[model samples]
Target: MITKILQYYRGFVRARIVSHSPERFLNLCRNHQIILQDLVYRDGYYECQMDLKDFQRIRPIAHKSHTRLFILKKCGFPFFLYRNRHRKVTYISCALFVIVLYVMSLFIWDIQFEGNQKYTDDVLMTFLHSQGYVQGMKVHNVVCEDLEKAIRNEYEDINWVSARIDGTRLVVKIKENTGILEIEEKNYEEGDLIADKDGVVVSVITRKGTPMVHKGDTVSVGDVLVAGTLEILDDSGGVMAQHRVQADADIILERTYEYNDYIPATYIERNYIKERKHYFIQFFDYRFQIFPVEKKENTEIITTKNQCHLFSNFYIPVYYGSCQERIYEETEKSYTETEAKQLCERNLQYYFKNLKKLGVEIIQNNVTIKWDVNGCTANGTIVVHEKAGKLSQEQQVEETMKANEYH
Candidate 1:
């Protein structure tokens, strides 16, 4: 492939040799170190392609072989230039286009992110913009090591980051910490674990602090499940001092979640009439239309764009593709009883799926859906077993101690 490209750049020719001694001619050409491509014989004549320089050296060989050479076809850059030499303006425009492309290549045209889970592309791009790194910035200004460090410092969950420049694109790859995050012991402030929802305690395991509730105990929102202060005792069993620490515990509880959802019977449905397609070419911000676009009401335009690139990762700002306009009409429609019930069930299932994603174990689903002429309604309670505590300030421990002293 590379040889062919070089041949085209240097120009080449196909010549027919009317020689009685074709074998001798070929041997003489080879002995003279001449390269011939696409050699063939047909109807008592020989034809082959050779570079212009080699063709120039072939005249003496042809004369010795008693052969006549005829230039059948000329191809490649030199011939193209000679044929279009009169079109000076076209040549100038082409040179200008190449120069523009080269200039654009010095600046970043696209910014891409990979291996991101918790943070989205927009979030990362926004951060980069705030740090004065953005698309169209000079590629030479990008310090990949600094960018990686900045990203790692900015996002706590990002465990590893790699930033690199690929052609005209800034590519950032990050690996997020998927394991459970642990708080540093030095940063653990005095706090107590309190119930964030109403539930019956299934189990309690304390890692630090005094347990205020036990298994099978009923708890309400804001009630302390574990106290952050421990009562230290003297030899005589009197309280010597109260040592304050952060409360750490896992409390599983059986809770009921109230679920309610409804959907209207009447809805708007779209009926597509026809689809019209138009092609467009875009250079940076300017767009040129290849086909005339018609203006119509109640139409949805879906466009697919493909950016121009020299190869992988060498993207440019030029884009071209097709836009499809789907013309549609809206009509008022009513769902049947069965359809309404099915939709309500689907919504209920989605709610359950979300709850399961949060590590909730559904014990029982008592929810039911009913459909009437007006709409569908789902109402009931979902029984689930889930972790049920959040950190709260340690003021509750002091209050509990005062209450104990009063008693």
Candidate 2:
């Protein structure tokens, strides 16, 4: 295989030799160190293939053997170049295409987002555009670490972010701040733990200070559940001294709240059609789609962006892509009783999930779901038991006075 390829590159010739003694000619050529391949004798002629350079050296041997050599074919890169040497435009166009493709690959062609929930692609891209990270810009101009840092700093809800380049595509990943609760800070100054809302006290655990309320006690908003001041009693049961400290406690309260939800049976929904228009824009390290005209009301538009490639996954930063805006028209959609019920259940699940994130424990939930030809409604009473106490901020002057008194 390797020999055949080398022979083709160096140019090879297939020739027919008219010789009375074909076997003697072949032996003489071999003895002269001439490389002859595919040698065959047929119809009173010797046929064989040899390198173009060796073909020239064989003329003397053919003459000595009294054989007439005629080239049946000449093929290879060298022959092709010689055949098309006069076509200047073809060669120039081929060279320019390769040079252009190589130059385009040095910049970004596409931007993609992953693991994002609160921030949309448009929002993230807009922010990146402001940072001079746009599409069609050289990859060397953009720093992945700096881009991640900028995104995290601008969006407080993003807990972590990453930026990376794959081929000509710029990939951005983000982890939003969700579900996790903030840690409570420690306060050394005197303060009281008061009821955050009016509810029945289900349970209480005092970690510091004194508990002013007990289980089954009904409290109102702003009422102190735990007192921050401690009184020292004398032998005669008289107050000897009083000291103020920060109160810390967990006070779980049982509360009932009304939950109501309504979903219309006949709703307007968008029906997308195949009609599409494309618009492309490039920023430094980011590229996106833009609408040339104003979008239609009550229509749903879907846009898809892809990295442009020169050939066979060989992507280039010069994006030549289109945004297909699938035009959609509003249509009336009717929901059956079963569908309405399913929708209501989904909403209830979402609501409960959010409540659980706030550390609320559901003690009882009695809900009623009803559906009609017009719509569906879900009404219920949710009884949750949760911590009802929060620390009240102590005034600056009072804190100073307390500190002085303690000293």
Which candidate ranks first by lDDT, i.e. highest? 1
- Give a tens-digit lDDT track for model 2, residues 34-89: 98888887888878888889887988888888888999999887999999999999
TM-score of each: 0.62, 0.58
Q: Once superposed on the true structure, which residue ranges of model 1 sit more than 4 Å away at CA?
A: 1-98, 115-164, 172-200, 216-224, 228-247, 390-407
The deviation in Å at residue 329 for candidate 2 is 7.2
Name the best candidate (by TM-score).
1
Model 2's TM-score against the true structure? 0.58
Model 2 residue 127 lDDT score:
91
Q: Count of backbone clashes for each model? A: 0, 7
Clashing pairs in 2: 133-285, 134-283, 134-284, 134-285, 134-286, 135-283, 135-286
Error at 177, model 2, angstroms: 7.7
